[model samples]
Target: MNCKFLAIAVAVILFCRPGHAQTGATVLDDFKPSSLNQPGQEYPQVNSQGYVRFRIEAPKAQSVVVSLGLGGTRGGTPLTKGTDSIWTGTTAGPMEEGFHYYHVTIDGGVFNDPGALNFYG
Candidate 1:
């Protein structure tokens, strides 16, 4: 019993260890829905600094990716799947100001943000 208790304590400490933290970066709290957002939709938003954040719902998807800033670093940002069936992530850096096109790829399939309006250009 004592041995088991000691093992449990060690495991707890290891599990609770802090992860590498971010430094010297501040994301402003001034995010707003993009002008391309459909009425009443607000998942894909952009901050004043041009950082784009995306939220996609795909509970069973094995992977999710956005085409924003493609061919750039990390081949675009990948969304982390959450327990609530939603995948979310932010751009690695601020995007260029002006119109940019992006789409979501889930589990090898491509789809558009339901909250965003589509354009043909």
Candidate 2:
């Protein structure tokens, strides 16, 4: 009888403990963007005329394209090599003020910039 009481007590103690005591609740973040292209930044490389310029860093990519809405798809001009694993492109003209999308086309794959903070429809 004493052994039965002890076994029941042990079972109650084990089941009564809070679940968080073993594993706490967690907040999960799904780090997936809706698009492979990135949105334009609020600020770009400004020229003397104060036209904001945009820069896309894709040194590994043989071909990078920036599609500016209404402005058209601008190819990666003056691609320069860098120390890191990347290929870069710059535009001669300042990016027109508006919504834009860009992707680094590498080996026929498009990727979004994790650092960029913009998105397009």
Looking at candidate 1, the ten consecutive residues that score lowest on lDDT are: 15-24
**Residues 1-121 of candidate 1: C-alpha lDDT, one tens digit per residue:** 9999999999998556563122356878688899889999887899987778888878889999898953355667799988788999888667768888888888889988887999987
lDDT of 2 by residue, 1-121 (tens): 9999999999998657654221232323222322323363432333332232334556556654444322324444334445774444334343344445654445566666443555668
The predictions' CA RMSDs to the true structure, in order, are 15.3, 21.5
lDDT values of the candidates?
0.81, 0.44
User: Once model 2 is optimally superposed onto the true structure by TM-score, how far is the C-alpha of residue 60 displaced, in angstroms?
Assistant: 5.2
Point to the candidate with the largest lDDT: 1
Note the clash tally of each candidate. 0, 5
Model 2 TM-score is: 0.38
> Residue 12 deviation, candidate 2, in Å?
81
- Give the number of the best model, judged by TM-score: 1
